[model samples]
Target chain A: SQTIHQWPATLVQPVGSPLSLECTVEGTSNPNLYWYRQAAGRGLQLLFYSVGIGQISSEVPQNLSASRPQDRQFILSSKKLLLSDSGFYLCAWRAAASYEQYFGPGTRLTVT
Target chain B: AQSVAQPEDQVNVAEGNPLTVKCTYSVSGNPYLFWYVQYPNRGLQFLLKYITGDNLVKGSYGFEAEFNKSQTSFHLKKPSALVSDSALYFCAVRDIRGAGAGKSTFGDGTTLTVKP
Candidate 1:
């Protein structure tokens, strides 16, 4: 069975601070990773997706960026956080041949 | 461009009654559709998916969705509603032949409330 793990389940940061959220999937290799943000009562917005190591496709232009440093490790980072960045950040992964995505527990970010 | 639409923002249903959450999509070529459920403050859970073949797809928690090609709709249905079934449901679509083949476009989501 495959399991996805995310760190700092909840985070609170001051405005203009750096942000880093990590996601790692065990039991799967060469999976498609994605980063999404959801505001209160709003639909999810895809921020970035990576097909392979060092390959990242961004869907929205914003203050966040994603990286696939390792086959099973994906990281979402930002040099500086904005107030608008406060939301629930979710990381998901899908098998290379599968269409359904599995999501991690997600991190609740609050930029004050 | 592929897109999904969940017409209702919220759906109220009484327990023991049948429930249906409407979803419609637009995409070129064949569309891969999916349904997900989200509890409060939690990540989305994959309930079911329609990649090919059968129009009726059954998924976790006794939920099923019917794919209507002509109407371009994939509606989630349950034989009987339960209070625990209340949650946010999302419909998503992906175009296999488009530029963003693996990328899915999600609907705004519909909140389902099952009353006792």
Candidate 2:
């Protein structure tokens, strides 16, 4: 079975600080990876998606960026965090043959 | 562009009663609709999907949804509601027309509150 893992399940950071959230999927290769952010009581906003290594598509141009450094590893990063950047960040992966996406536990970011 | 609409922001249902969370969509081509459930402070979980065939699709935890092509709706339904079913439900749609076609557009999400 495939499993998605995300680190620093919860984080508290001050404004202008750097941000890094990691997501890794085991048991799958060449999967489509996505990054999404959900504000309180709002729908999910797709931030980035990657089809392959070194390929990233940004849905909404913002301070955040995503990278697929390895086939199974995806990272969401930001040089400087904004107060609006505070939200629940979720990472998801879908197999090339499947339409359904599997999500990780998610990282709750609070930028104070 | 593809989009999904969950008309109701929240739904209230009593335990043991039938429950329904409405969802409608708009897409340029054939659509792949899906339903996902999110518990408080948790990631979204895939509940069911309607790709083709069988308008009625059954999924985890005794949840089901019906796809109505004419209505452009895929409403999530459950015959018997449970208190545990209280959570946020999201509707998503994907248009099968281009590269990276599986990327989904999600609705604002409907909060299902099954009262005891």
True contacts kept of each: 0.72, 0.72
**Candidate 2 residue-wise lDDT, B30-87, digit = tens:** 9999999999888999999999999999999999999999999999999999999999
lDDT of 2 at B57: 96
Residue by residue across A1-112, what tens digits does model 1's lDDT show?
9999998899999999999999999999999999999989558899999999999999999899888989999999999999999999999999999999999989999999
Q: Comparing to the true complex, what docking class would candidate 2 get?
A: high
What candidate 2 keeps of the native contacts, as a fraction, is 0.72
Residue-wise C-alpha lDDT for candidate 1, range B1-116, written one tens digit per residue: 88999999999999999999999999988999999999998899999999999899999999999999999999999999999999999999999886869899889999999999
TM-score for chain A, candidates 1 onward in order? 0.97, 0.98
Candidate maximizing DockQ: 2
Q: Give the least accurate 10-residue stretch of model 1 chain B, judged by summed lDDT.
A: B96-105
Can you tell me which runs of candidate 1 are displaced by over 4 Å?
none
